[model samples]
Target chain A: MDYVLLIEQLLNGFQLGIILFLMAAGLTLVFGIMDLVNLAHGSLFMIGAFVGGTLTLVTDSLVLGAVLMVPAMFAIGVLVETIALRTLYRRSHLDQVLATFGLILFFNEATRLIWGPEGLAVPLPDFLEGTVALGAGITYPLYRVVIIVIGLLVALGLYLLVARTRFGMLVRAGASNREMAGALGVNIPVLFSLVFGIGAVLAGLAGLIITPITQAAIGMGEDVLILAFVVIVIGGIGSVRGAFVAALLTGIIDTMGRSFLDVVLLLFLPPNAAESAGPALSSMLIYILMAGILFFRPQGLFPPRGATAAP
Target chain B: MKSQLTPAHAVSALLIALCAAVPYLASALDEPFYVIVFARIMIWAIAAISLNLIMGFGGMISFGHAVYLGIGGYAVGILAFHDITSAWIQLPAAIGLCALVALVFGVICLRTRGIYFIMITLALAQMVFFLSVSAERYGSDDGLNILWRSDFGSGIVDLEDGAVMYYTIFAVLMGCLFLQWRMVVSRFGMVLRASQSNETRVQAVGIPTYRYRLAAFVIAGVMCGLAGFLQANLERFVSPDMMNWHRSGELILMTVLGGTATLFGPLVGAVVFLLLSEMLSTITIHWHLLFGPFLILVVLFARGGVMGLLGSRTTRD
Candidate 1:
């Protein structure tokens, strides 16, 4: 129970929470606005990581690579939406799921084809490199601190945009009641596409940031995307505020549980059994949390104000 | 109720006949590969049929149905690990365990409808997958190998023979199809379908839809577990891969490819999907690159799947 280790793990959890929020934000928005379950959202995340990593290698600058990859990822997202997902908007949720699933396969294999099976790693810049010393023998990576700051800034910016802007109002309206929003002369299709694009950009941002920490692998998106799914579902689909809160909660709980569940379990069971069971139980923590949340609050922690019902 | 044979029923009969005859035909041709392939197909067909029962007729899309396969596979593998390789013990253990898992998970999942249900099921499956992966003693990600198949009795049923194994699997598949057919026409299944089409209406009529949906989910789970048991025996191995989300997606794809709400659609879907991939992979490693778009086209154009192409009315009652 060293303080430094605890702090490091806490920071790790916070960093994970931020990354999850980035992924979950777009998912919640697209789901909230378009009412489409895009299983391939993870593909977009993977594309961002790969594209960002590739651009970084080509440009030899992390900032520039991120800059270039954002729009590229945005364009990819819009293309997928326009080509594959647009036709599915009017179809049932099952159809949307199936179609997006197809997109997932296409993207995963396409990545493997183009990038090869080996994962790419993004190098951190000099300034972003190195560790910062906190009190009590604590040291934190500058990259992770930056991620937390960037995530918070994005959260604030998103909040202001959604709360203070007219377009945001329309997004809110559409999410609440698409028919009513359509009746009010909102260009529903364009708005939906824009929301989807914004979501793609957000997901890409998360992916780009994490490339330095994690290898930009072909199938990386799905692992995080599942957590993102759990985040949104627990946060309540279509609610960004809920997503943000739930994402952080999940990230912290999962990380802490993973790191310390064995220690906690040792108190109850034989040392060998606890050692073996801890990891398994810790891995299941968030899902259990999600199930518990759903069992209690099926609509999620934060259902949009007027819409107690899901779209 | 009609005595006249429809295209759907005729297709089902043809499928069953072909499945039953494949082992013998392959034996005649001395192609053990076909026997192996068909055995794998029958395994998947059973799982797909179970998925179709819930997804098509019950209108519950469980994205993690393959978890039952993992459960069943692991049940056999774990039992064999501890030296309990009896078919009677292992088979029922797998089914019972999967059913129990399904019961607990299904109860919670049924609380949510639509996309939430799908996500929850996926999450639950991932939970099982991760737990299995962490179980280092059981081979975890590497999976466990079963040295011997489930022994039914001394010389009563020898699974070591490929022909016997193939026929056993085929018989189980046919028996499942028959049971599924009977279940669909049964009063319980009628109520399940009714609830699927209109939950509110069914509830207004005083039917406990949740119980029926849970029952369907459990039934599907048990059937898939049976598939898993056969799969582990067929491969003589069990791994977390058997329960991966991708496998579950493939099961969904198979059911959809064949046609949902049709009894034999799963069989058709599994055969086409497995055979196509098997054939394609030999030509190139990037078969998924092509297979991916194929799935999209099927969803986009061939909405009802292969059986729908054969003029079966896949629509719900």
Candidate 2:
């Protein structure tokens, strides 16, 4: 095993973790607070990338486009909540799932219609186009490092907003008991919209950030959204901290397993057998972990305190 | 639960008769494609009916129900590829394997309720999907094409003959509906439905609900596998796409759109859904744009489904 390769993959895992955390955070909050399962959350990610990437292309300033992406997604979030999802909060989980799944179909087709089938190119600005060297002769892309920093900063900001502010307390209260919070004069509907907007922003930001690295093709978020679901399920739904922890764990496990499972499998099986099984097993590693976790603790590793599992 | 004839049962009978007439209707209209299209609908209808057993009646919503369809397809596809074309072997293998997988998955998934059950089932199915996609020896993402249809080893049931294949599917659909009707009305199904409404109460009444649910889940899986088996025979093709998350979503849509927990609802829903898709796709490739919003509207307001709109019994939550 080369030490350099190991360190590089670790960084890769970390970077992936940061991205998953961004997506999972919003998902956890929405699921926690609104008690809605928004499968179209991934559609927001796709829309964010498309809308943000387009803005950048038109304005020719990545910073401005990125800044504008926030309010754009937030407004869309609020609009969707008020229109499509508000009635769904009290509906059955199956209804929420079906509605959101419909949203996914609608959004994907809408994107194809508006943006055409081709992915929009969000070219890296000149300054972000280089690699930075760390000590021990290991170097990594500057863009990925920036993503890590931005992700951590946002994570910290979210923590402070959720933990330190009065609104954060209300949000937590809403998660724990919505009826109590409503009786206590919290504007529950407005709060729901606000939290939904925040989730949209986070999901959009995650999408916008990664579009430069991966093509913002139609339905790009569908695959990643499943991974986010895995994060929340393993982390326990309605728990932000759990989402964060689960996201990173999922990211690292997925990345490392994909890169190194074959080598590890070689020790236990013949070369040809190991080669075929490696990819399949690696892709399944996290799900196996999730199944194991669920078998032992169906509520997940860090279920929210005092919140009903179904809600 | 009633023995009297109702509009629901009449509609179901009418639809099945329509399905029986599809081949003749197609040939009379001189359009061979309609036979295949209605056959496709019947296959999905079977899958939808299986899903309804667990979801509509049992209250165990499996978002990954289509995986069995894929597994069934692959069973036949892989067997036919290896020159094991006998329906005797392929049919049993598909049903047995699907039942076993459903049993294991049901054990783990039943530990959770509501959304967790939904997500876990979907995730597990996705696990199988990724495995299939990575199986380079089995044609992976491109899917595998079988050279021979399942050999029933008799002159009477040649699958390569389109009429025979279509009728086989029709018989299977009729069999599934009969089985579903029988199971849901039986003592076991009553226990299952009772548990769905209130598990604790049912348990207090001295009925163990877990085994009933597990049995229903496995039966549903086997039914869906039969759908997959027929589909593979119809197309002579199998791919991971058959079992992906989207297919599962569509199955759920069919069950719900036709009205869940009702006799004939799956058939009605499948007919409407596939017909709509076929009609919409003809107008433009972006039919999902319309179809998607329509689904949302259905979920939002038309929760009763086509059968419900047509005077089926009210569906329970």
Candidate 3:
């Protein structure tokens, strides 16, 4: 019944929504442009968190670490694409899924071997730490507010790039029809590599930014990766606009459900029943939403115009 | 129609014989642990075979197929926790619940194909996983331990006996292989296989492929649930981890490793995968570093899996 708590929860939801968008954006783009289901996208996210966090700590500056992390992840993404994923593009989706899955196991264990089994804690730099007040006694973490702004800026920048640029047109064309795009003289391989690089950068960005709040940890990517998968599934795979909307929807619903589903359920169900069902139901909220959406719109909320009707 | 036997057939026979004789072999070798190890493999093999039914033959790649295992195991575990010891009730409930859930999931998932199908199944199964993880009454993430196995009358069957348990699993494994063999060759199986290659063409021939697919989905679910039931009995415990997405991926890997769409591929794949894991873990704690790339190599070069190597691509398929 407290309004301030509700406002704070909403802000928390917004922050989560932004993070989910960052992860989902890369996944949707890679899926749309290259027709690859990279399960190790999560591994890239994990690597970003580990590498970026380490760099920030070592350099004693967050900006320097993030700035350096982007290209490194981009290179890694491109390297993986050419070495493992490129061959899989022509193969069945099953093959693509399994290969990326292998990549996931490899990355997780490699991180464990290097970082050891213990998770890394990335403390917030002094300047970025504090509470930001938004009038009427409502306060939110300054870092989270920063995440919301940066994520929104990225979303806007992405929208403009896709809408206004010639490269954007190529991306669209490739997504819609790779063969025709290649026939018209687009460097499909180069374009695919570039898109893959971009995806890795986005995943890394999401990973690094969230680390200060969540701390860089091993196997952290799989849970969030599954969330991103749900977002894209609900948003329609390969659609950035869809990813944006669905990510926010998923993030908000999930945070709010986890925070207050028990309270809400208590109004209807008896005490013990509501108490037990609340947390479980809350965790299941987005999936239930996803299932409902699939039941209604099998293609998702924003399926690409021609997302390979073949199969 | 009769067909000539090939080396794949010999391999298949050998595998069944090997599984059947695991107890004697283990005792002869004086490695009692091998009985437990191979029992776990057979249990996983049953689950993988069920996954292959839809994924390989039907071309419906359900990334969340392992959820049925969790559901089945939980059914047994929860009932046993509450003092329900009868196998009759627990077994039927597991099968019926898994079948019903699969039917519901099939209605929604079958609506999509390819990657969409894959993601949706993964997400829905995650839903059930979370549900179990949150069930505080059932020990939640810690899972429940069963002191007693299912009772099938005093003298009719005793699952608690190791040899009896081992033989029971062997019977079930053979039953699954026989059932899968028969199902994939029947008119229904032919229709299902044709649909996998080309659904539009199958429909044009006046067959309702949707119903056939739904039926197959339910059957696969029931089969996997049976595996879960046996697993709970074998391990004497059931945890939410049984249904994790990682386990689902492994099931897919096993099917592909043995050779998708082949009759004995699931069993072959399960044997190799578990054995490899067992062997690798002993050599080093970081077995995944090796195993992961090995999976990649298999997908890249060994596309037909072990059965494919044995010349098992029958013309009938």
Query: For candidate 3, what is the interface RMSD?
Result: 1.1
Ranking by DockQ: 3, 2, 1
Task: Provide the DockQ value for model 1.
Answer: 0.77
Give all TM-scores, in the order shown: 0.98, 0.98, 0.98
Residue-level lDDT of model 2, residues A194-250, one tens digit each, is: 999999999999998988888588989988899998999999998888988898899
Q: How are the candidates ranked when ordered by lDDT, highest leading?
A: 3, 2, 1
The whole-model C-alpha lDDT of candidate 1 against the native structure comes to 0.90
Candidate 3, residues B13-46, lDDT tens digits: the string is: 9989998898999999999999999899999999
- Clash-forming residue pairs, model 1: none
Off-target runs (Cα >4 Å) in candidate 2 are B3-5, B314-317
Per-residue CA lDDT of model 1 for B212-316, tens digit only, reads 999999999999999999999999999999999999999999999999998889999999999999998999998888888888888889988998888787646
**Cα misplacement distance, residue A196 of candidate 2 (Å):** 0.5
lDDT of 1 by residue, A192-290 (tens): 888888888899889889999887898899989999999999998889999999999999999999998999999989999999999999999999999
Quote fnat for model 3: 0.87
Query: What lDDT does each candidate get?
Result: 0.90, 0.91, 0.92
